[model samples]
Target: DAGITQSPRYKITETGRQVTLMCHQTWSHSYMFWYRQDLGHGLRLIYYSAAADITDKGEVPDGYVVSRSKTENFPLTLESATRSQTSVYFCASSPVAGTEAFFGQGTRLTVV
Candidate 1:
C-alpha cells in the first residue's frame, strides 16, 4: 500500500496477555508514533521511534513497547495487557516533526 496500514483494527484480549499491533508505512517515514485515544481524554503518546535503532518513550509509554527494525514498519506490543489499556490505538508517521502527519485508521483494543 502507498499509505500507512494497521492490522487487527479491533482486538479483544484478557488481562496479562501479550498483544501486538502492527503498523506499516509505504512512505518509509523516518518518524513513527503510537498513541491511544480514550473517551474522555485525548490521544496520548505511547511510544515513538525516530528511525531504526532509535526509539523513545512518549507521554504514556507504560505497559507498551515499540520497535522499528525497518524504516517502513513499527510494531507496538503490550506486555500483559490490562483493562486500562483498552482504547483506540493510532499509528502516525511524518517525514519530520511539526509537519503534516499520516495516521492509520486505528486499532481498538479491549482488555477484559
Candidate 2:
C-alpha cells in the first residue's frame, strides 16, 4: 500500500508565480500536514487538516494554502511564489501529532 506521495520531486521557478504541490496518501489517515524544510528553518508547518473539509493554518501558512476535500489527498498552493519560499516541501500524514509521521520524498522548490 502506498503510504504517501508528493509530486515534482524537484522544481525551479521564478520569483513571482504560482505553483501547486500535490500530496496523496493511501492510508486514509485523518490527519494530513504540509511542511517546509530549509537550511536554518528546519521543519515548519504550513497547513494541516484533521479531516475532510476541515483545514487550518499552521505555523507558516502566510504564503501558502491547503485543501482537504478527501481523506486521501491534500494539495498545497503558493498563491505567488517568492524567493524566500525556496525550500523543500514535504507532505506528512499521521493518525495524530507528536507521534511517528509518514513523509513524502519532498519537493525541492527553487525560486530564482
Candidate 3:
C-alpha cells in the first residue's frame, strides 16, 4: 500500500519557473507538513496544514505555498522558484505534532 507518495521524485528548473510538488497519504493523517532539506539547514519546515484548508506558515514560507483542500493531499507550490530554493523536499504526515511523522520518499528540486 502506498502510505504516502510524492510525485516527480526529481525535477530541474530555471530560476524563475514555478514548480509544484505533490503529496498524498492514505492514512488520513490530521497533520501534514512540507519541509526542505539543505546542507546547512538540514530539514526545515516550509509549510504545514493541520487539517483541510487550515494551514500554518512554517519557518521558510517565502517563495513557497501550500494548500490542503483534502486531508489526504497536501501540495507545495513554489510560486517563484530560485536557486536558493534548490534542495530535497519532503512531505510528512502525523496524527499530531511531537509524534512520529510518516514521510514520503522525497522530491529533489534543482533550480539552475
Per-model TM against the reference: 0.97, 0.94, 0.96
Query: Which candidate, 2 or 3, has the higher lDDT?
Result: 3
Q: Tell me the spans in candidate 1 whose CA falls farther than 4 Å from its real position.
A: none
Candidate 1 displacement at residue 47 in angstroms: 0.8
Question: Compared to the true structure, candidate 1 yields what TM-score?
Answer: 0.97
Worst 10 residues of 2 by lDDT: 93-102
Show where candidate 3 strays beyond 4 Å: none
Where model 2 places Cα greater than 4 Å from the true spot, the runs are none
RMSD of each: 0.7, 1.2, 0.9
Candidate 1 has an lDDT of 0.92
Better of 1 and 2 by lDDT: 1
Provide the lDDT at 52 for model 1: 89
* Clash number for each model: 0, 0, 0
For model 1, name the residue pairs that clash: none
Best candidate, TM-score: 1
User: Model 2, 83: alpha-carbon shift in Å?
Assistant: 0.3
Cα error of candidate 1 at position 99, Å: 0.9
Number of the candidate with higher TM-score, 1 or 3: 1
